[model samples]
Target chain A: MIQMFHVTKAYPGDPPVLVDINLDIDKGEFVFLTGPSGAGKSTLLKLMFLAERATRGQVLLAGRNVARLRESGIPFLRRNIGVVFQDFKLLPTRTVAENVGFTLDVLGTPRDEVRDRSLKMLRRVGLEHKADVSPLKLSGGEQQRVSLARALVNDPALLLADEPTGNLDPALTVEIMDLLTDVNARGTTIVVATHDATLIERYQKRTLRLEKGTVVADERGAKAARLMSQTA
Target chain B: MSVASKLAYFGRTAIGSIVRSPFVHVIAVASLSLALVGFGVARIARAQLDALVDALGGEVELTVYLAEDAAPEQVAELEQALTQRTGGEVHRISPAEALGRLATQLGEDGKALTELPQNPLPWSLEVRLPKAARDAEALGELSRRTRALPFVTGVDYGEEALVRLGLIARALEVASLVVFSLVFLTAVIVVSATLQLAIFARREEIEIQKLVGATDRFVRVPFLLEGLLQGLLASGLALGALVGLVRWLESSAAGPLAFARLDGQLAVEWPRLAGELVGIGCALGLSGSFIAVRRFLRV
Candidate 1:
C-alpha cells in the first residue's frame, strides 16, 4: 500500500514541482501515472521510492510514516520498493548476471543463491547466454530486461518505473508492458509514469492523469475489474 | 551475518572483480610496492650507517695540545685534570706515548723523530673516546671544554674526522627527512589514486546501490576492504623487494657496505621493515576508504 497526503516539493527559486498532491493505492494495484511533460509524475514516483523527500506532508508506505524517516533509514525503507529508470542505470563494469545479482548482493545473499537466482532471472529475460557479458554491451531492450531483472531480484512489494517503454519500439513496448502485466499478476503493486498516449489508450488500465502538479482524473472502465483482480 | 562479515563478503566480490582483470590490479600493486621498496631500503641504509658509526666510538681520539716548555708538575696536573674530567676510566695516551704510537703507526721512515729536535709533536693527551666517529656534537662539546684548560693550548680533533662526522650527521638527517617525505607522498598517491579509481569505477554502482536500499556504510565497506587489500599487496611487495635489496647488498657488495653495517647486516632492518610495511598497508587501506566513502556519501 502507498499513500501520499498533501505532499509538496520545490527546488530553491523554482516553482513547486509537486504541489500539495494527495493519492492512495491499495495493496497490489498496478498504476500508470499518465501526464504531460513537467507534470511532476517522475517527482511523485521519486518521492514514493524515497529517492527524494517530501518538502511537506506525509507519505505512508505499508503503515509506516516514511516521510518522517531519517536519511540514514531511507535506504532500508527503499528495499521493499523497486524502481526502474528510463535510462536503465545498469553498472557498465558489471556483467548482466552481476547487475541482476546486485540487489541480492546488497541484502548479503549467499553466493550460491545469488548465482542461481541471477541465472534464473537472466533466463527469464531471454538473455541467459548474454549473462556473462557486461550490460553496456547489450542492446537497449536487452539492457532494459536486465534492469527489470535487477529491480525484481529482491521481490519488492512495490515497483515504480519511469517511462519504462520510452525508448522501445511499439512491438517491444507491447512486450515490456506484457512483462510488467505478468509482474503485476504476481501481486506486485506497480506505478509507471509515462507520457505515451497510444500506450495509455491501448492498455486501458486505471490511469492517474495529472496536469500542472495536480491529478485531474483517476479513470477506469472495462478493464477496472481485471486491474483490481490482477493485484494480490 | 554481522556488518563486518557482510563487508568481507562484499569485499570478496570486489576483489573477484578486480582479479578477473589481473593486469590493472597487478600494475597498481606493483607501483605501490616499488615505492615502498625504495623507501624501505633508504631507511635501512641510514639506520645501518648510524649504528656502524655508533659502534666505532672508541677508535676516534682527541689530540690535546700541551703548552710549550710545560713543567712535569703542569703535565702531571693536566693529566690528573684530564683523567678526572673524562669520568676517570677514559683512555689518556701521554705525549711520549703519543710519539710511540706515531712511530708504530708511521713505521721507521714515517718516524719524524730524527728530523725534529724538540720532539715537535705536542705533549698531547690523546683522549680516545670509547664511542664511534659519527656525529660532531659531543666531540665538539668536549673540544670546547678542554680548550678552557690552562695547560691545554688547544684540542686538535682530527680535522678529517670532524668533517666526516659532520657530513655523516647531515647525511643521516637529510636522508631521514627525504625518505619520510617520499614515503608520505607515496602513501598519499597510493591512497588518493586507489580511492579515485574506486569512485570512478563504481560511480554508477554506488548510485544504484543507494537507490536500491543500500546504505552509505554498505556501499563503502567493500571498497574499503579493496583499498586495504591493495595496500597490503603493495606493502608486501615493498617489504619483499626491500629485503631482497638488502640481502643482495649484503651478499653482493659486502665490501662497500662493510664500511657501515648494523647488526652485521647491510641495509634495512628486516623485522622493523616488515612491521612498517604492514602498518603502512593498514594505514593506506583505512585512509583511502575513509576519504573515498566520505566524498561519495556526500550529496
Candidate 2:
C-alpha cells in the first residue's frame, strides 16, 4: 500500500518538480504512472522508497510514515520496498546470480539460502541458464530481467519501477510487463513510472497521467482487471 | 549472514579490490614497508648505542688529585667529602702507590728511577659514584664541587667522553622522533590516496549496494578491511627485511664490530618489536580507509 498527502518536492533555486500531489493505492494493485518526460514520475517513486524526501506533506509506504522515519531506520524500511531503474542498475563485475542475491546478502542471509533463493528467482525470470555469467555478458533484455530478479528476490511487499522497460524492445517490454503482472498476482503492490503512451494503452491498468509537476488525469482502465487476470 | 560469513565476504572483497588494482596497492605497501624498515633500523641502532653508553658509564670514576703540598689531615678531610658526596667507596692512593702505578704503566722502562728527581704523582682519591650519579650532568656537578675544595688540585672524570655520548643519545632520540613522524604521515597519505582511487572505481557498486538497502556500515567495512590488509602486508615485509638485514650484519661484520654485541647477541626484542609494528600497520590502514570511506562513500 502507498499513500501521498499533498506531497511537494523541489530543489533549491528551481521550481517544484512535484507539486501538491495526493494519491492512494491499495495492496496487490498494479498501477501505471504515465506521463511525458520530466513530468516528476521518477521523483514520486523516489519519495515512496525514501530515496528522496518530500519538501512538504507526508508519504506513507507500507503503513510507515516515511516523513517521520529516522535516518538509521531507512535501510530496514527500504527492505520492504523494491525499486528498478531504467538503466537496469546491475553490477557488471558480478555474476547474474550474485547480482540477484545482493539484496539478501545485505540482509545477512545465510549463503546457502541466498544462493538457493537467487537461483530460484533467476529461474522465474527465465535467466537460470545465465546465472553464473557476468551481467555484462547478457543482452539488454537479459540484463533487465536480471535486474528484475534482483529487485523481487526478497519478495518485497511494494515494487516501484521507474521506466522498467524503457531500454527494451517492444517484445522485451511485454516480457518484463508480464513478469510484473505475475508478481502483482502473487500479492505485491506495483507502481510503474513511464512516458510510453503505447504501454499505457496496451496494459490497460489504472493510469495516472502527469503534466509538468501535477497529475492531470486519473484513468482506471476498464479492461485492466480482465487483462491482468488473463495474463496471470 | 552470520558474523563469520560477513567477515569472509569483507575479506574476499578486500582481497579482490587489491588484486584488481595491484599497482596502487603495491605502491602503498612498498612505501609503508620502507617507512617501517627505517623505523626498525633506527630502533636497533638506538638500542646498540644505549648499551654502549651504559657499559662506558658504569666504568666512569672521578680521580681527585690533592694539592702538591697538602697535609695528611687535608687529604683525609677531602677523602671524607668525596665519599659523602658520591655515596660510594673513596679509595685513597698515596703518593708512593701512585708512583708505583706509573712505574708499572711504564712497562720495563721503570729503571728510570721514577722518571723525576722526586716522585711526581700526587696523592689522589678515586671517587666511585653511584649508578644514578654517573650521568654527564651529575658527574660535572660533582667535579665542579670537588675542584672548589681547598685541598683538591684537579677533578678528572673523562667529562668530554661523557658529554659526547650524551649528545649522541639526544641526537638519536630526536632523529627517531622525526623519522617516525614522517614515516607515519607518508604511510597514511599513501593508503588514503590509494583507497580513494579504489573508491572511485567502485562507485557504481557502492551506489547499487546502497540502493538495495545496504547500510553505511556494510558499505564501509570492505574498504577498511582493504586498508588493514595493506598495512599488515607492509609490516610483514618490513619485518622480514629487517630480520634479513640483521642476519647479514651479524654474519659478515659482527666480528669486526665486537663491541656492538650485547651478551653475544643483538639486544632487539623481536616479539615486542614485531607486535608494535603490526599494531602500527593496522592503525595506519584503519585510519586511512576510514578517511577515504567517510569522504567518498557518501551513502
Candidate 3:
C-alpha cells in the first residue's frame, strides 16, 4: 500500500509537475490513474518509484515514510514494488530469460533458482520459445510482455506500470490487462496509469484522473460511464 | 547483494570487459613498454659511466720525467722530494722502459717510430695517489707542488683526459634526466586519459549500481582493481622488453658502448642495471595505478 499526502514535485526551468496531490492506495486494491497527456502521470509513477523526490509533502510506502527515508533505503522500497516503464527499459544485451531474472540477480538470489523462476515466468508470458533470444530482436508486443514478466517475476507486493499497453495492439493490450488482473487476483496490488478510455471503461476499476498537476476527477463508476462499459 | 557476491560479480564483469578490448590493452601495454625502455636506456648508460669512473678511478698516476743524464742520487733526491710534496708514492720509470712504452703507443700508428735512434726518453717517477685524490684544483695543486721538486722537469697529471671525461659524465647525466622526464610525462597523460574514458563508458552502470545499493567504495573497487591489473600487466610487458634490451646490449655489445674504449667487462655494470630496471618497472606500475584510481574516484 502507498500513500502520498500533498505531494508536489517541481523541476528546474519548468512548472510544478505535480500539485498538492493527496492519494492513498490501500493494500490489495487494483486502482487506475487515468489522465490526459502532461497530467503528471509519469511524474506520479516516478515519485512512487523513488526515481525523483517530491519537492514537498510525504510519500509513505508500506507504512514507511519513503519521502523522508535516506537514499540508501530507496532500494529496499523499490525491491518491494515492481515497476514497468512505457518503453520497457530492458537491456538489449540480455536474453528474455536473463531479463526476467535480473530482478532476482539484484536480490542476490541463488543461480539455479534464478534460472528456474525466470524460465517459469517466461512460459507464463508465452515467451518460453523466445527464452534464448535477445529482447532487442523481439517485437514490440513481445518485448512488453517480457517487461511485465520481469516485473512480476519477484511477485512484488505492489506492481506499478506506466503506460504498459501504450504501444501494443488491442489484442496484446487485453492479454496484458488479463495478466495484470491475474497477478492482482493472486494478491499483488496493481496501479496502472493510462488514458485508453475504452480499456478503462471495460476494466471498470476505481479511477483517479489528473489534469494539469491537479486531480480533476476522483470518483467511483459514474452513471453514463458505467452503462456504456456494461453494454460494451 | 552481499560484499562477496558483489565482488565476484564485479570481478567477472571487469575481467570480461578488459579481455574484450584488445586495442586498448595493446595501447596500454605499448605505453608501458615505451616508458620502461626510456628507464632501461637511462639506467644502462648511467651504470656504464659509473663503472668507468669506478674502474679507472682518477687516483691518477703522473710519470714525472727526470733529465736523461741526472745522477742516481739526484733521482733519489727528486723522488723523495716529490713524495713529500704530493704525500704519495713516486716510483722511478726506467729510461729504457719509458722508451719501450712510448714506442708501443706511437708504434701502432707506424713501425718507423720504433726504429728511431737511441730512444731519447727521460727516466721518470710514476707518482701515484690514494683513491681519495681527485678534483682538478686538488690535482693541479699537487702538480704544482711536484714541479717545485728537484729535477722534476714537469708534472704530467693527465689534465686533458680528466677534463674531457668530466664533460662526458655531465653530458650523460643530462641526457638520462631528459629521457626520464619525457617518458614520465607521457605515462601520466596516457593513464589519466584511459581512466577518464573508462569512467565515461561505465557512467550509467555506476549510477545503476549505486541505486541498487552499492557503497561508494564498493562501486570504486572494481575500476580501481582494473586499473591496478592493467598496471601490473604493463609492468610485466615493460620488464620483458627491458630484459631483452639488456640481453641484446650484452650480445650486440656492438652498440655505441662496444665501440667505447673502456674494458667492456669493467665498464658494463650488470648488477646496477638490474636494480635500476626493477626499480623503474615497479615505480611505473604502482604510480600509474594510484594516479588512475585517484583521478576517477574523486568524482
Top candidate by DockQ: 2
lDDT (C-alpha) at residue B175 in model 2: 79
Report fnat for all candidates as fractions from 0 to 1: 0.77, 0.59, 0.11
Q: Which regions in candidate 2 have their CA more than 4 angstroms from the true location?
A: A13-15, A223-232, B12-24, B41-59, B64-133, B140-155, B160-164, B244-269
* Candidate 1 backbone overlaps, count: 6
Number of the top candidate by lDDT?
Answer: 2
What lDDT score is found at residue B113 in candidate 2?
Answer: 52
Mark the regions of model 1 whose C-alpha exceeds 4 Å error after superposition. Answer: A12-15, A167-179, A222-232, B1-8, B20-27, B48-99, B109-175, B240-266
Better of 1 and 2 by DockQ: 2
Q: Could you give candidate 2's per-residue lDDT for residues A1-232 as a string of tens digits?
A: 8899998999999999999999999999889886777889888888888879999988988788987888778888888888887788888777889899989988888888999999999898788999898888998778878888899999999898888887789887887899899999999999998767678668788977777889877767765433333332
lDDT of 3 by residue, A124-198 (tens): 888999998988899988898888888888999999898888878998789889989999998999989887777
Question: On a 0 to 100 scale, what is the lDDT of residue A200 in model 1?
Answer: 66
Q: What i-RMS does each candidate reach, in Å?
A: 1.8, 1.5, 4.1
**What's the candidate order when arranged by decreasing TM-score?**
2, 1, 3
Instruction: Score each candidate by Cα lDDT.
Output: 0.76, 0.81, 0.72
